[model samples]
Target: MRFLVIFLLIAKIYADDHELHSKHHIYKELSHLDLTKEQQHRVKKILKIYRKELKEYKELEEDIEDKRKDIFLQKSFDLEKINSLNQQLDREAHGIENRFLQKMHFVLTPQQRKKFVHYFDDWEVE
Candidate 1:
């Protein structure tokens, strides 16, 4: 019984780590732009801020999912609660973009901004 419990715990931890890595890989792929050192540093700072927001968003999403599951199991729904949570999630999403843009604007020159836009245009979000 103890061995089984240990194995399950290890598996759960591994799965969590894998999920975190996968998320990081996806974000890296989506944001893969060839940047100079200065550009990279500035973008890294922006991404750092984004990472914190994303972590919170993921927790909120998990909470929302748990609520959804509870509703389904109970054969009841709370539309207002769900909507409120969703609105908060939406605000966080918008805040992520706005904060990133604000940071970028402060860190990048006009020419750099143009280049950054081109890079983003070239990137496929998928």
Candidate 2:
């Protein structure tokens, strides 16, 4: 059904988000940037804050998976509720990313920031 497709899409998006959000993973990404000691400290601080915020997201993502399974397994369901939850989840996810980027950019110097553009680009999964 159409609802099932939408649910699967939401699940897929969150799964991708979780994969991209690995705490140790970003450290590997920054290893090539040749960061200074201070830069490394700032990055670790930012990552710690981001990880703290992510705890709530993990619970919400789990809830999403559960709701998605419910939709597939249950005969009676409210499509409107599912759509609303999806929108809410999307907003929360984007908000966290936006905040993280802003703080991350604030931490980097202008020169370091120049390299950040390229680093961010290459961070995309193929």
Candidate 3:
């Protein structure tokens, strides 16, 4: 019974670690680039900034959702407000994505960029 308990605990730990790695699969793909120490450091900083921006984006999305619900709850529909929110969403999405790509482009070598682009084929903005 003790042996079985320990085995289950170990399996649980492994599963948790696997879930974390899967959530940030970018790190796994970046590992294949074989970055130099300086490149890795720079990339880590870039990712930190990217993550902060993403968090803000997510908050904006949630706020927009709340506003949309409020709009519907009102007796009159606000089509203009709905359109404005959509445009803001589009602008924020494109701006964050383009900036991240540009920063990564500057940090990576041509060969690394080639490989990185392939990994992005399956990548999602969210």
Candidate 4:
């Protein structure tokens, strides 16, 4: 049916968007690390968990955006409702990211943690 087709298309688009987000963060983090084989294996395992969390976060964000778009497209749009939903999505995403960072910090040594922090600082300024 036409409705089914449209639903499938939208699902695929959202899935691709999530994949892109996960890949971008993974590549960025990996680029910053100088990992030995063992370290690389550990990092990969950590990243696997992070990526799953990120994918869920991304899906939540996409759902929020879709809802906002639907509201705006209606004749009687509620900006306040959309804003509240967006804020909730933002908070949830931030919480997930913070948890991931905490896990990553726990896994790294003091020196590695400093290196990770320095990498992010440098990355931000560049």
* Best model number under lDDT: 3
Candidate 1 lDDT over 5-74, as tens digits, reads 4233323333444545534433454344445556655555565555556556567767877876776677
Best-to-worst TM-score order: 3, 2, 4, 1
Cα lDDT tens digits, model 2, 5-118, are 433333333344454444334445565566766776677667565555565666787798788778868788878878877887788767766787788788777877777877
Note the clash tally of each candidate: 0, 0, 0, 0
Question: Model 4 misses residue 125 by how many Å?
Answer: 18
TM per candidate comes to: 0.57, 0.62, 0.73, 0.61
Cα-based lDDT for every prediction: 0.56, 0.62, 0.68, 0.60
**Candidate 4: tens digits of C-alpha lDDT, residues 1-126:** 432343333333335446555444444555555555566555556655655665576678778889999999999989899889978887876676577677767767777787788644322100
Prediction 2 TM-score vs. true? 0.62
Maximum-TM-score candidate: 3
Which pairs of residues collide in candidate 4? Answer: none
lDDT of 3 at 33: 80
True-vs-predicted CA distance for residue 11, candidate 1, Å: 22
- After superposing candidate 1 on the true structure, give the runs of residues whose Cα lies further than 4 Å from its correct spot: 1-39, 119-126
| Per-residue C-alpha lDDT of model 3 across residues 5-103, encoded as one tens digit per residue | 433332333344454543344345467787876776677667666666766777898899899899989999999999999889878867877887899
